[model samples]
Target: MTTHAPQTPGHPLPTGFPAGTMILTRRGLVPIEEVIAGDDVFTHQRLWRPVTAAMRTTAPTVRVHCASLASGLAATADRPFLTRVARVFLEGGEAGELSSAGWTRARDLAEGHRLASPLDFGKPVPVPDLPASLTGIDPADVLRTAGNMIRLKGEAAAALRPELVDWLAAQFGGYGARRRFPAWALTMPEELRTAFLDGLVNDGPQRDQFAVRMHSKSFMVGLRLLVCSLGFAGGLSSQGRPGKPGWLLSWKREGGRRPDHDGFRWHPVTRVEHGPEAEVFSLSVAEDESYIADGIAVRNRTERLTSL
Candidate 1:
């Protein structure tokens, strides 16, 4: 039987939605499972609340094959594939207006279909265009770490050790001619950088050789560390290299250990196999440990788990 770790006192699992399960409500796009009957869902640039909720059997179930064209292009060119995903759907009432709306899949969502947009004084607003490419780092961590440093008083921020900052900067700043620095690392103020790195080093077991190695150099590595630090499992993958170099970072989940104790663990994906279905993959961590993503598995390994 699988056992779950006891909840930590001060820390909680990060909030997120399962793959392929988000709904557009007055608050913007949220996981459909998270929606309540009274919550306002977006329809025709207006808010509509559900009166009754029921699950009924239907003749044909909808499925979408939403592909990141960019990632597809990169896969063809033999580069890292970074397409991430989450589930989204329209409620029954919202679907009535569309011609091919019933059981419509994400790939089928087209122009004229209204989705819940972020609100400005209860009025739906247009969604903004996002950058075609992202740096593969979680934006939340960057904002939180920066905010923490900014909140520190003059002496506290300035008192950080110089050597620590230099070491961190070197690791994230890149080592050779072809290397590129993380955008956050390049833009962060000197004092903030010092404080951020110092917090991670001092928060937990810095003596662990594996931990040191995992947290060193790569901004992506540090981002994984940050995700694990926040008490969630993080999966990393790259194109061409399936498992050897990919990292699975997570805190201890089953042991009865102190929550504050930073027991970060790292594993390499030894193997990756295509699932019986399309857009699905199974990852092997060890002889006895494996997890399925985007498959029939009820529980997923990671929120952003994707094929490489």
Candidate 2:
């Protein structure tokens, strides 16, 4: 009697496949956003490509990844056409032919973040020889309020409140509780509290025989969407394989740069300010109609040349 070998089973492999997908997060392990975005993030690029391709094709994935820094995902995973368009990123697909352009935009944003203050994500990226600081506050602090400052001010997300920063630090500190994801619960089922507690310490029961599986199956992938071609998502550099390095922008800073006009604040590098009354000091700009009209003439006579 010809009998096929009995299928070895756990989470039984789909026969003819159930149109499955493979996911990877933390490239396997998971951690905080800043840590993941640190200098050594590129350590696992080859592995992520296949995983990202799975995201494009699979039903969905919910994952936490500092590499991209966002979570909780749905909806976009089923975009049938997206798979067709992004086939090049997937395995058994076409990662080889796309050329550098496929990843150019992502890499550029990665570089920009790196250019900002390496110590703090809050600072702006300085421009060469331009007088001014990129940012005056910590990026972790500023990130919270960045959105609120613009559109959702006064909401929970706005970084304006100091409490938020503290809370973030507590959750990511490694031993504290994370009300949101609760690291303890991931290892065992959420329903059991004692088991989670028993495993909470370093290399405790929580680290083995229980830690929930880690993955980039969905959430971190969603971050990729938000950051697409938009520059860094207002955060730190993403350590990815061959991911570009951060940068710094600096230029000369002389006094009397900022200026005010018609109730508007014009930047200092571009303008100079003069005060009103007696007249109070105000900002002014170095506008040269002549230069605009005739670039060749200015280039020929300028005593100092600088790159803007």
The CA lDDT at 130 in model 2 is 13
- Writing each residue's lDDT as its tens digit, candidate 1 over 125-185 gives 3322222332364544443343233224234633543222333333333222212223233
Off by over 4 Å in 1: 1-20, 44-46, 54-62, 66-308
In candidate 2, how many Å is residue 58 off?
A: 14
Prediction-by-prediction clash tally? 5, 51
lDDT of each: 0.26, 0.19
lDDT, candidate 2, 170-260, per-residue tens: 4222211111222221122222322222322223232322211212222222222222111222221222333322211111112222221
Clashing pairs in 1: 19-87, 20-86, 20-87, 21-87, 22-87
Q: lDDT of model 1 at residue 77?
A: 11
- Which is the leading candidate under lDDT? 1
Residue 131 displacement (Å), model 1: 30
